[model samples]
Each structure stands twice: as C-alpha cells, then as structure tokens.
Target: MRDFLPADKARRERVLAVIRERYRAHGFDEIETPVMEEYSRLHAGLGGDNEKLSFSILKRGMNAEAIRAAADDPAALTDLGLRYDLTVPLARFYATNRAQLPTVFRAIQMAPVWRAERPQKGRYRQFMQCDIDIIGDASARAEAELMTASLDVLDALGLEGGSIRVNDRRVLDAMLDVFGFVVEERPGVLITIDKLDKIGPSGVVAELRDRGATTGAVDALAAYLDRPSSAPSFDEAGIRAALPTGIPDEVIAHLVALGETVAAARGADAPLVFDPFLVRGMGYYTGTIFELAHPSVDYSLGGGGRYDGMIGRFLGQDVPAVGFSIGFERIVDLLQDAADTGERSVVLVHDRDVPLSTLLALKTALIAQGVRVRVEQRAKNMKALLERSAADGYASFASVGVDTTAESLELRPLN
Candidate 1:
C-alpha cells in the first residue's frame, strides 16, 4: 500500500537489521511462508477480528466450476486468502516439518500480511509482522524469554520508558464469568474491553449496553475497572480478594514467575506491568496476553501471547506455543521520521565518448570499496553539478573523461 524511496527504505532496513540481530542473539532461527494460504486456514477462528477482514482469492480455471456450483456460499468460491498473521502459517509450517525441526523450536518470522480493514493512522491494510515464537515449550520460561526478547529489541531501537501490560486469558475469563457474562458472550466482551485504550471506560459501558449487557453487569464492570493501583503490578491476591471467585493457582503462579524473572533480569527499572483489563483480541490466546505501550507514541508498538491450541488445528494435538510480534510497519514509520542517515555518495561525471563499460567498471569498483556512486555525462557547469550532487546526499564528485582510465580516475570532495 506504500512505496518506500531510498531514504525511507534504508531506515526500514536498519530497524529490520536490529530486530534480526536481536532475535538471533536470543537463539531464534528465521523462517518464511507464502503470502497466501488456504482460506480455511486463514478463517480457522484463531486470529480474532483479523479472520473477518481476510482478503480471499477466488477459485480459478477448473476450480471455477466449483464456484458456479456453489454460488450461494462465498467461501465455496474462494480457495485461498492472504495470510493475516505469521502465527497461523507458522503452525502449518511446523506441522508439516515437525520431524525436521528441533524438539524445542525458537523461530523468527518477518513477513508482510494482508487485511481488508479500513486503514487508520498507524494501522494499514497491508503491513509487516516481525514475530519471535517458542514452540513445544510450555514452561513459563518460554513466555518470559519472548517478552524479554521483545523488550530488548525496543531497547536496541532506543525506545525507552515503555511498559508491557501483561494479563492472563484464564483470569480474564474468570472475571467475566463472575461479572455474569456467559460463555458465548466472553469473546465479544473481551474484544470490546481490548478497545479500552481507544474508547475509554464510558464508551465501553455504552457499547456493552448496546450489545445487550444488563445494567447491573455494566455497572459492576465499571466499578471493577475503577479498582485503583498506583502502578501496574501483578497483585493476584488483591484481584482474588476483590472478586469472590478465585483465579486458578497455576495461572497466578505462572504469571508471578514471569513477572519476577523479567524484573530481576531487567533490573529495578523493568517495564513489565500487570493490567487485569488488558484483553488482547486474539481468541486463540489460551494463557498469557500482553500489549506494549510507550509515552512517546499514541499506539502500541506490538503485542502477542500464548496460543497453545492453535497448532492443534494442523497437527491434531496441541503444541504449546507463545509469540510476540513487533509492529514492523509502525516501528519503521517512527524511525523514518527521526532517522539521520549518515549516508554519503560520489557522483561520477564522464565524457560523452567514455565507453559505457569503463564507466560501469568504475561504478562497480567504488561500490565494492563501500562507496555509493552514481554515474552521468559531464555537466556543462561543474560547480552547478557539484552543488546538485551535494544537495542530493552526494558528498564528493569524480571525473572520467575519454582519456581517463578506470584505474586513473580523479575524485574531489564537494565541500
């Protein structure tokens, strides 16, 4: 949906390099999948709202007969859809190649995904997702490592003073149940709650009421949201005390362990926080969910969580997996606005009679020596040419007349 010019593209690549280096340092190996995948896989009820906005590809050639036969159902006419995220495709990839992969796989994926949603300021219909996932390891350590790696990437990018709001799906479910929400309404309720940052408490209450929630339920939910904490901390005991029904001890312990590990590793100034109301929209997230927030930015950098059940759709058995995705597009956008590219180049001005091959050889040699070079015929006014070159990020100029050999070219700095 966007075309990146040289400077913009360079900034994006710089951010990607930082991400790739950080992920590799954390022992994640990269993998790639096709942009399009089976429509059934994309619509597998795991991606939450993303599934609804997926762009499907219609059946073609011989498959067109099926479309004609099943005209009543749009899905029958569509065989594939562009992948909305990397997680689902990774599930399929692992399921297909599980035998070749290690028992515990730490994988990194960087790829563009498509969605058909209406674009907003930072949200795009097509954007890149940079994901690091740990599969086959169900321990709390996996979640901690993922969270730590994500924070480390942000730190590498100089994005400080940001906080990661952590929560557990089980705790959210239990709390919703206590608030008189039924099983069927939990997803809708959680999805709306996920918009708390954008819509605020009053908007949420109105939306809940419009969605058929009772007056008492709405008021109780609002009152609970008012439970004050000076700072975000995982206070399972306080939460359990406030609600009569307690959350599972295992869930509490896992969360506590993750928080402690991250804090100790990151020292006293660690940015991890516990916000009970942080309900990420992905429905497949079975355990922990988190969102990253920064004071300098209005939107989240990125988020992800434990989708222990997603791979089951492919492998027929649950393969515990947890992942975090950095909003690559958004990160690049921020970096581009603030990037100071220390790039310099030399413009090669050659006589009209200079052989094209000779000029090409000079260009290649300069490129090999780590110099950015551009070649053009000699301009009439040398001062004007040098001025133009300097304005366009070139720091120097080189002359290659008909008598000048590739080995005897003279270079002069503009400034």
Candidate 2:
C-alpha cells in the first residue's frame, strides 16, 4: 500500500533481520506461504472480521453472465482470496508439510498480507507481518515461550517498555457465563468488551443494550465494571483479585504458571502482565491470547493467540498452535534509522572517460575481497553523488580511472 525509498526500505530490512535472527535463536525455522488461498478456507469463520476485509480473487474463466449471476452468491464467483494474515495459510502449510517437519514445528513467516480495509496512519491494506508460531505444543510453556521470544525481539530493537497483555478466550467466556450472557450472544459481547478501554463501562452497557445483548447480562457486566479497581498483576492472587473472582480456578492457575515461567525465563524487567479484558479480535483463538504493548504507542505493536482448532479445519486433526506477530510497519517507525554502515561497503566513483572494462575490473576486485561494491559514474555535482552514495549505505568511495588497478585507489569516507 506504500512505497519505501531506498533508505527507508533498508531500514525496514534491518528490523526484519533482527526479528528473523532472534526468532531463529529461539529455535523457530523460517517458512513461506502463498499470498492467496482458497476463498472457502479464508471465509470459514475463523478469521473473524478479517474475512470481510479479504481481497477476493474472481474464479478464472468467468464470463459477464457468470459474474452477474453469481454476484449475490459470491462463493460461486471468487475461488481465492489474498490472505489477510499469516496464521491461516500457515495451518494449510503445516498440514501439507507436517510429515517432513519436526514433530513440534516452530515456524517463522515474514511476509506481506493484504486486506481491503480502509487505511489509516501506519495502517495499510497491504503490509508486512513478522510471525513466529509453535505447533503441537498445548502446554502453558508454549504460551510462555512465545511471549518471552517476542519480548526479546522488542529488547533487540531497543524499543523499551514493551510488555505483553495476556488473557484467555475461555476467561472471557467464563466471565460472560458468570454474568448470565447468552452463549449465542457472547461473540458480539466479546467484540464490545474488546472496546472497553475505548468506551467506558456506561458506554459498553449502553451499546450492549443497543445491540440487543440480554438485559440481565448487560447489567451484570456493567455492575462489575463499575466496581472499584486495584491494578491487575501478572501473578495468580493479583489476577484473581483483578477480575470477577470466579474466573474458573483452572484458567487462573494456568495463567499463573505461564506468567511464572516467563518471569523465571526473562527475570526482573520482564514485560508481561495480566489483563482480564484483553480480548484480541481474532475469533479463532481457542485459549490464551496476547497483545504486545509499548509505552510510546496507543495501538498494539502486534498480537496473536492460541488457535488450537484452526489446523484441524485443514488437517482434520487438531494441532495445538500459538503465535506472536510483530506489527512490522508500526515497529519499523519506532526504530532509529540504522546510522552505521558496513565498513567494507564502498562506492567506486569513476570518470566517464574511464573504460568500462577497467571500472568492472576494479569493482570485481573489491567484491572478491568481501566488499559491498557499487560503481557510480561521476556526475557534475560530485558532492551530491557522494552524499547519495552515503545515504544508500556505501561507507567509503574511491575514484578510479582507465589505468587504475584496485590497489591504486584510495577509499575515503564521504563525511
């Protein structure tokens, strides 16, 4: 949805390289999937609102009549859609390649996904997503590993105060049950709950009634929301005391263990916390969910959660999965443009009078010596050419003439 100039593009890649390296260090292997998938799969109610935002691809060989006739029944027209996120396609990929992969597959997907939604500041219809997922692990350890790995990535990027807000879909469900909400209405209720931070308790209650949520359920949740609050903590007693107390002891225990594990792994200054209200938008989430937060931004840096039932939609067998995705576009802007260039990166400024073969020879020699080389013909404004080369990440430059050997050139830093 946007174009990056050379310098901006390079900066983006630098961030991606760090993410890739850190995830690999955590034992996740990188993988790629197509940008499109079967429209049926994308619309299978797993993607939540993203299904509506998907860019559908029309079926091949359709005539005007076919298109017109199928306009109302879109399934008869479009057979594929650009993927809205990496997780769904990953499910298909794992199902197809599971036999060749490790029993517990840890995979990385750093690629662009497309949606048809309206774009806003830092939000685009087409954007890069950096995701790391672990499949076949159902324990709370899986969730802990994911949060720790993501926090480590934030640390590597020098984005301070990056913490994860953790919650469980089951906890949301339980909270709804305790409040006497209808099972059929809980999805819409969850959607409204996700907006609690944006809209206060009175607003949620009013909107729920407007949306026809059960009256009793609305009043019940409203009552809890109005209760005096002590801030939530990542610890067990704190979590119990934070939300409505009856949040299914099993879930509280699970979250406690998950937080403890990540704390032990990341030590003090670890940025993990419990937010009983943190309902990530994706409906496919079957258990724990995460939303990565940074102190400098109002929007989430990125998020993902457990999708234990998603793969079964493809493989016909359940595979436990949880993933963390960094909002690549959002995070890239937070990073300082990399000021350091590789010392071996060099630009060869040559006069037009220099023979092509001689210039080629000089460049070839530097590259053979492990230098990043570029050959630039001298321009009328020598200073501008040198400045541009520096911006393009060339560290030093040397002039070369027809008779110049690689050894005869003296490299000088542009600045």
Candidate 3:
C-alpha cells in the first residue's frame, strides 16, 4: 500500500476541509460517482487523444481460452474502463436521473481519476480532481458564478493574489477568420499558440509553419498572439478600431459583452485579467475558457471551460454546461513549497494502558470538540513519543498514562 504518514494525512485533510467549506457555501451539493464505468459511456463525450488513455477491463470469470481469444480480437473486448474525468460521468448521471434532481443542478465532486501517464515530481497516474459544475442554464451568470466560486476556493486555500486568465473561443475564431485562416485549421493554430507562454514567439511561429500554415500567415498569427500584457486596454472607439476585418459588428459586440461580464464579476480581492492568449488544451471547450496560475508558478494550477455540446453526444439532446477542475495534486506540491508552520497537534495514547475502545472514544470526543488527535501505533516510552511527535512537526501532544483520569489528562506543548 502507498504510505500516507500522519503529517501527510493531516495536511491533505486541512486542504480538503477548506475546499468543501467554500463549495458548500456557494450551494453546491456534494455527489460521488463510481471510479470504474462502462467504456462506451465514459468515452462517448471525450474525444481526440483522451479516448486512448482510458483503462479498459475484462471480466474475471471468463475462461483463459476465451480471454485469449477476446484479447486477440479488439471488437470482442468488454465495456468497462476507469473514468478519466468527473464531468463526463456527472453529465451521464444527470441525464439518466434528471427527474430526481432539480431543474438547475449544481454539484461539487472530489474523486480520483486514473491516467496511463508517466509519473513525475508533481504528476501522478492516479490523482484527485476537485470539480464543480453548473447545468441547465446558458446565461453568463452561470459562468460568472463558477468563476467567482473558483476564486473563493483558491483564496480559501491561501492563494489570495493568483490570476484567473480568461478568453472566449468566439474571439479566437473571429481572429482566425480575419487573418484568412480556415475554420478547419483553427484547432492546430490554437494548440500551437496555446504553448506560446511555454515556448517563445519564434517557437510558436516555427510550429505554425510546420503545421502547413504559410509564412505570411505564420508571421501575422505570431504578431497577433504576441500582444504583450502591457498592451493598452481598448476603449469604445479603440475596441471598434481593433475589430478584425470582415467580421460582423454583432460578433464583436458579443465578444465585448463577454469581456464586460467577466470584468464586472471580478471583485476587489481577486482581479480577473483578460488574456487573449489563454486557450485550454481540451478539444471540447466551445465557449469561454480559463486557466488559474500563481504569480510564482510556471504551470497552471487548474483550468476549465464551457462545453455545451459534449454532454449532448450521450443524451442525444443539447444541455448547457460549464465547469472548472482544480488540480489537487499540483496544488499540494505548490503548498509544500510555500507551506507555513501549522498549529494543529495529535496525541498518541499508549496501547498498553489505554484500551483501543477508550482511546477511540477519547479521539472522537476531542475531534467533536475541534481537536485533532492521532493514536500512536509504535511502542515507545513517553520521552521517545514526545520526541517523535516533535519531529513530525506537531505543536503539542497529549499523554495518557495508566493512572490518567478522563478530566485531567497530561497535555504537553512541544518546542
């Protein structure tokens, strides 16, 4: 089994507590789905490279010969696979159980998703995704709410000044059309330009040229995408002046509306910055897209966007949806680097003097009273126990001896 020592468990619990509190305060009901699901249902909404990563399974009861035969023929494989993300399964869940839920459904799910990816320092094959989504409305209000709630979650986790970069897909599409690029080539152009922050302008131009875009087109795209953060904000006349050639004024008006909505929703605490270059990696995003990044971190901590058509593939009907997922593992890694000293403590009772039942009861009571307690497993003297607790970074410890009373247990504050 993977090891989760006392300190690690404590830190994870603290982060989860903050996440749950912030989501619930915004009226999101907590729901959970099974980790494994039928492969068809899991893959129905996901497209492109996402389908290849699904971990499919076969029934265990099948005979060896039959299993071998099925394995040889891809069509004979069964339907089960591990869920890659929470939103797709949740969409299926809502469609199947719509009658039971309210017209407008808001849910917050915290669960692990499996991926067949190479493990690195902060990347894991199995990691938790903290997701929140709103369904049944196509209003900008839903988008604003999701963004506001996301800001609250990150702020509650101590990332107060982080930036939430946002951009509209319509704006990007209009720009591509104005630059004489076909609609079919938009994805390639977007994916390449999305990496501009990681790879510089020269690299993006090289990638565009390699993707069959002409040299002139590549130069224009590079200059457009390379607009620095210091570029001046557009006033009414300036916005009209910056409109792409041949695009309708109505489309530009819609883009202006989206920008105004986002700016108005942003509070004084966490300012929302308009990022024309922000395009999420997912192929399903059909509308406003966003990514959250810390000032000091090079990679995005989390991101999500509107995918109104993704769920329609399964239900065979349109459903309006928008979601944001927090990268819990990445956040944990960043927190490890920036973690300040915490004040919580756990007391370990000697197994010999304190029976397991009594120790559990004490723990439950203390927990109810807002005290964090951990029962000691290793056999050691009081001095060793105290030293171990201190080394684990605890601020205090409780000592339960044979002669200790319920009302007057010894409490030791660590140095």
RMSD of 2: 1.9
lDDT per residue for candidate 2 within 1-415, as digits (tens), equals 9888877888888889989999999989999888889999999999989999999999999999989999999799999999999999999999999899988899999999998878897779999999999999998998888888898898888886788888999999899999999899988888888888999778888899999999988888888888888767778778888777568898888898898889899885567778888888888898999999998888899898999999998999999999989989888877756475355888888888999889888888888899989998889999899889888777899988877887789999876
* Residue pairs that clash (backbone atoms under 3 angstroms), model 2: none
Q: Which one is best on TM-score?
A: 2
- Number of clashing residue pairs in every model? 0, 0, 0
For TM-score, candidate 2 versus 3, the one ahead is: 2
Worst 10 residues of 3 by lDDT: 229-238
| Candidate 1 Cα misplacement greater than 4 A, ranges | 62-66, 234-245, 340-344, 353-361, 380-396, 399-415
Residues 1-415 of candidate 3 have per-residue lDDT tens digits of 1456766766776787788889889889999888987777766646556667777787657798888888875436766888888877888888788789887888899988887766677766678899989888777667677777877888888887777776767667777776767777888888888888888788988988888986666777767655553532422343444444655666455445645665676643335555656777777777778888788688888888888887787678998898889878878766764442475666655547567777777778777877667777546566787777766666677766555555776677776
Give, for candidate 2, the lowest lDDT window spanning 10 residues: 334-343
Per-residue lDDT tens digits for candidate 1, residues 138-220, read: 98889889888888898889886767888889888878877778777777888789789889888898899999876676788
Q: In candidate 2, which residue ranges exceed 4 Å CA deviation?
A: 341-343
Give TM-scores for every candidate, taking all chains together and pairing residue i with residue i.
0.88, 0.94, 0.85
Local distance difference test scores for all models: 0.83, 0.88, 0.73
Estimate the TM-score for candidate 3.
Answer: 0.85
